[model samples]
Target: MIEIIPVDTPSLGDRSYLGTDGEVAFVVDPQRDIDRMLRLAERRGVEIRHVFETHVHNDYVTGGPALAAATGADYHVNAADPVAFDRCPIEDGDVVEIGPRTRLRAVATPGHTFTHLSYVLESPDRPPAVFTGGSLLHGTTGRPDLLGREHTGTLARAQYASANRLARELPPETDVLPTHGFGSFCSATQSEVTESTIGLERRVNPALTRGEDEYVRSLLAGLDAYPAYYAHMPTLNRAGADAPDLSAPRRANAAELRRRLRAGEWVVDLRSRTAFAAGHLAGVLNFGLDGNFAVYLGWLIPWGTPLTLLGETPGDIAEAQRELARIGIDRPAAAATGGPADWAGDDKPASMPTATFAELATVRRHRPVVVLDVRRDAEWRESHVPGAVHIPLHELPSRLHEVPDGEVWTHCASGYRASIAASLLAAAGREGDVVAVHDDYDPHAMIARFAATGGSGLARHPL
Candidate 1:
């Protein structure tokens, strides 16, 4: 019996699956952390014999090459792709044996990427299981726009054809597993569920149900901007990421951290957003250890930026490092761990300034305050403060100047991003003028919040 164990990254809601018939196991679409898979192999008393990648991943760094090297297993990728690093190049119709009753057949499913492959596992006396990397998903298909604005239409068409081909070619009872559908920004829309059979998907998947031209148009329209780090992933995955070092980062003294900050290293504060807003170092930015840590860090921080970290404990620092590794940020210069007391002997505590929604309204009325709405474009278009300045949180550091010289109160759907923006706004030294509204806000109800305050509060009216 083939035992399939799913290794899920809850932070990103992405999954990698492990399949074994006891002695030999194969991992599909692994994250950068290979130890989890290794531990599973040890637990199962099986040897990891093979590692397969569906495509060059754009969301997180892949574990395939590193896993292959560690276990002396074959790491497979598409033969047609121009990967700089070595891999067992596979093509359509090529079969890979995993065990006596199990083997994987590579099928060309070129929509997510030009050379994407789906591995179909054949086991005796049972229906086949297809690992549709990014082709056909539960409710939607993989977004084709990751290749860029120019290739969107062509790839969308390709995705439609490929998705339909999968439905037609595979048996209805075939088990369907996909890598890109679950909240990874790779899918055209959020997948309703992570697991679905080919039979079930055919009945529900929009890509499978819609006409080819209609599917293409709908997919293109639904495509949203993915992380900027996505643009760098293909190259990095092709070249292969460096082996991860999960060891606690070397310790840096407060003085050294100060020096690094002066040297312009990306000084990151891995603390709770609330804790950070209450007290954090000047010029340091907060990305709470909770929330979408890896992807946002990958999205906002530039590629290969030298980094320094400040956190509360060894575990906190380690977790931060691991999250950073998820997207190929393998190294940080050093970490300064412990509370504010460790960093400041007796200096006054510092905090990222914050304001209440009511205080924000009061501030707005008294002066011309810039209500910076740091939500996504869609969220902003849906509804935001009537005269709020819109700049998505990820773009705030570089676009800080657009905020202008004024009392600025930042906000997003929830206060997570608003806190991060508040820190950045202050770190940019807007004359200590920025503050965060630490409240859970529904974008649609923002106008009502203003209207409830009465007297045309910042262009107040129901949205």
Candidate 2:
């Protein structure tokens, strides 16, 4: 029996699957989560024989080489696309045998990337299973504009043809296992479901429904912005390099950290918002080593920016380094040597501005205070506190004129965006008390308290 193990990298939140049959295993789209894949291989008593990338992924750095290094697995890519890795380039119809009975055939499915390919698993008796990386998803198709707008139309048309090829050629009963599920930026129509059948997707996926031209047009429309860091990912994957050893992550004491900071090094605090707010070294930018940590870091920190990490845990520090490497941001000066609390010094830590339910009730009972909900438009419409000005964090820098020059209480679904908004207001020389509100606090009570008592106890003044 063939066993498939899902390796979910919390850093990228990208799911990579490992397929095993006793003595041999094959890994698909191995992101930076190598330990889990190794453990899975060990549990099955198998050696990883091959590492496959469905396409040139932009969401996170590929871990194909890392896995290959640890397992002696041969890396595989599309024969058409010339990659610089030590790979066994396979064309459509090329087969990789895992055992005396089981094999995987490469199926050329270009369009997600110029050289994208899917794999079809065959084992004599049962129907085939297609492992589509980004070319074909359960409910949606991979976005066509990843390369650029110049080739978007060409790529979309190619992707459409490829999808049709699979729909027509692959058996209706083939089980389709897609790399990216719903909520992935890779596919425009990622489904909530992780797996589906070729026949089932053929009936439901919009990318497979219309004529070639119309389908291409539909795919191009409403395409969201790819993360800025994605532009550098393909090259990194092409030239597979060893990931920096995380167990021996570079560490520096407070004095060294201060020296580096002065010498143009950036301090990246990877602690959670709550931990960061409680007490953190001054001037360190908090990107909380959470979801899309690297994506935002690429935007906030300049390319090739020297970094010093202040993570909540050692694992968190390692994850920060891995995320940075995925996007080719590999230079880290060091990790903070001491714990976060130790670095805070003797100054009574300033509590992050917050309002209790009772305080909010009194504020809402009074007048003159405005709550600025700096969440996305969709979030605001879903359900938001009344009397809140909706301004998305991305738009906040440009739309500062819209916010009234009065005491403004800023909030997002949580306080993260609000803190960012508050910082922006301070930088803009705005003459208003800008306070970030934590999501855990009751908005109604805070609003009412402001109405009753005129404002929260915080003073209203310019930065």
Candidate 3:
């Protein structure tokens, strides 16, 4: 019998797979924290004999080398990659016996990266499962333009061919396990669920349904600007991140947090948006522990910027650190825990003014404050407050000049992102002028309310 377990980091919606055939196992695309894998190996009474990556990752730091060293497993990646690390270089058609009944054969599938691969597992005792790291996802494939815009067309073509190869060669009944596309920016298109079968994909996958030229067009056109932190991952993963030191980024007190903030270190408040807006330290960004915490942490903060995380508990700090480290934002100078009471002295605790959508409607019509829709471009396109400045929260730093230099009210689909943007504004000296719409108020409904009530109150939607 074969057991394939998933190591999911829900913060980023990323999954790594470990397949075992009783005596030994091989892990694919694991995160920086290899403890989970270690424990799994120990519990199953199996040694990890090999680790494989489909491509040089452009998202999270890989624990391939660390896990390999810890388990004495041979680590492998594409030989086409120029990563300056000792790795067992693998190419297409290379076969490995993971155990008695389970065997892995590598298929060179480039497109996501110039050196992407999909590993097809053959099990004599069970049905097959293919681990398509970034090449063949549930609904679509990894975005081709992650490396650069120039290679998009070339990569898209390569992806089209690679995806076809899997569809043509793999059995229809084979399980399709992809490392990305389930809420990860790595995918060209997002998929609701992470699991699918080759038969299901054969009928629904765009690469199969759409013509080659059309697939390339849609894939390239559908691509959105990826996080800047992405630019660092390939190189870091190639070189290999040092084994994660969970003990680093030692705890700090209120004073040290203050010092870090003063020194311009990114002080991320890993609490709820509501809690953060209620009261947080002055000049801290609320990249909340709840939302896509790691993605935003990497996006808004510059690469290699010093950071100090603030959390409600030690558990929060540890979780946040683990997620952040996955994306190469390791080694926070220090972390602090507790509420505003622990961090605040005689001075008043820092807080942002928040408004409900109804209140924001009134504010917008009466005083004409800049109603900023801090949602993504797609969200704004679907619906938005008429006349609201369209600056996605990630673009706020660079597009600050476009924001009106007066009182501004911000709202996202929910208040989580709005709170973060409001805090960023506050940190950039707009504390008095930025208002966070911290309620779970629907923006379009508010716009409809504005149409019906003349911004007086929430009312029935009007044409």
Candidate 4:
């Protein structure tokens, strides 16, 4: 039996695959943390003989080179990719036999990037499975604008044609295994459907269902801002990355932490959002371990800025390190474990109060306050708190001066970004004026609630 396993990096919304015939195996799109793949291969008792990369990834550094080196396997990358490493360059139509019963075929799916390829696992009696890395995702395709606005239109059309090509060439029962679409920004749209096949995708996928012109237009229109850190990924990936340095960083004392903060370095607090809101060392940004910690942290932190992690436990710092390393942040400058008191020493920790949407509605009746919407532009366009000030979380630090001085209630789709914003505002010496909305934001419901509270709701959309 040909068994396939996915190594899911949920924080980055990507997956790497390990396919085996119970003896030898091949990996696809491995992350920088290759230890996971090594351990998985060891556990399966399969010698990793090959490593494959579908494209020059823009999300995270690839582990293909490292894994291949460690296992003496042939690292496979698209022949067209200008990677600064030695590897088995494979192009479309090339097929490699994997044992007597299995074969791997490379198919050019140039939508995610000009050189992207999808791999097909074929066996004698079983339906083929295609690893459509960032090409054909569940119910959608990879977003085409990652390359640049100039290439978006052409790539969107290519993406539509690519999806159609997969549907036409692959068997209906061919399993559609995609690398993006699980909340990854690379996806044109996120999909909750976990499992799908080419046949199923043809019925529901926009690329297959809609005309090329319409699909291209809609996909381009829906594209939003991606991570600022993504600009660095392709370069690092092309250069190649080794296994991450998972060794514990130099332990920082309270004095060292203060020194780093004074030097304008990032001292991130990896605690729960509630704990961070209750009390955290002043100037320490709250990334919080409870949510999509790595995604937002990697998104907001200035690339190459010295990063020091403050966690309640050593394990938290380790987890954050692993997540950050996947995005090519190899190591932390230092790490400190314990409560805010341990990191604060003699300094008084800053505190920010958190509120729910219902509480926000009640408070607005008696007093005037600024409702800062920290969600992305697309989210704000969808439906936001009516009349809320729009400044995306990623833009808040640079645009802090534009915020009207007042008691600011910052919110996002969920409380995560709001908490981070509140911490940033407090770190910027606006502690007295910021409140984190620690609640899920539903714009229409908020409109109704505001109406019931005798506030203006007619201008806001109501459901």
Best by TM-score: 4
Error of 3 at 132 (Å): 0.4
State the lDDT of candidate 4 residue by residue for 1-463, as single tens digits: 8888998988888988999989999999998899999999999999999898988999888888889999999998988899899989999999988888988999999989999999999997478999999999999999888889899888888898889999999989999999898888889888898889999999999899988888888888888888888889999999988888899999999999999999999999998889988889998899988888888898998888999999988899999999898888868999999998999999988788999999998898799899999998777777666567999999998999999998999999889999999989988888889999999877667777677544466243222
lDDT of 3 by residue, 86-191 (tens): 8998899999878767789999989999999899999888888899998899978888998788988999999999988999998889999889987888888887
Q: Can you give the lDDT of residue 188 in candidate 3?
A: 88
Please tell me which predicted candidate would have the highest lDDT against the true structure: 4
Q: For residues 114-201, what per-residue lDDT tens digits would candidate 1 score against the true structure?
A: 8889999899846789998888877788888788778878888888888888899889898888887777888788866867888898
TM-score of each model, paired residue for residue: 0.93, 0.81, 0.94, 0.98
Pull out the clashing pairs in model 1. none
Residue 373's lDDT within candidate 4 is 91
Which model, 1 or 2, shows the larger lDDT?
1
Weakest 10 consecutive residues of candidate 4 by summed lDDT: 454-463
Native-referenced Cα lDDT, model 4 = 0.89
Once fitted onto the true fold, the runs of candidate 4 whose alpha carbons sit more than 4 angstroms away are 452-463
lDDT for each residue of candidate 2 in 269-300, tens digit (9 for 90 to 100):
77766665565565555677654577666744
- Residue 347 of model 1: what lDDT? 56
User: Positional deviation of 70 in candidate 4, in angstroms?
Assistant: 0.7
Q: Model 3 lDDT vs. the true structure?
A: 0.84
Which residue runs does candidate 2 get wrong by more than 4 Å? 211-214, 255-264, 337-341, 346-348, 355-410, 413-416, 419-433, 440-463
Instruction: Assess the local accuracy of residue 358 in candidate 1 as a C-alpha lDDT between 0 and 100.
Output: 62
Error (Å) of candidate 4 at residue 296 is 1.1
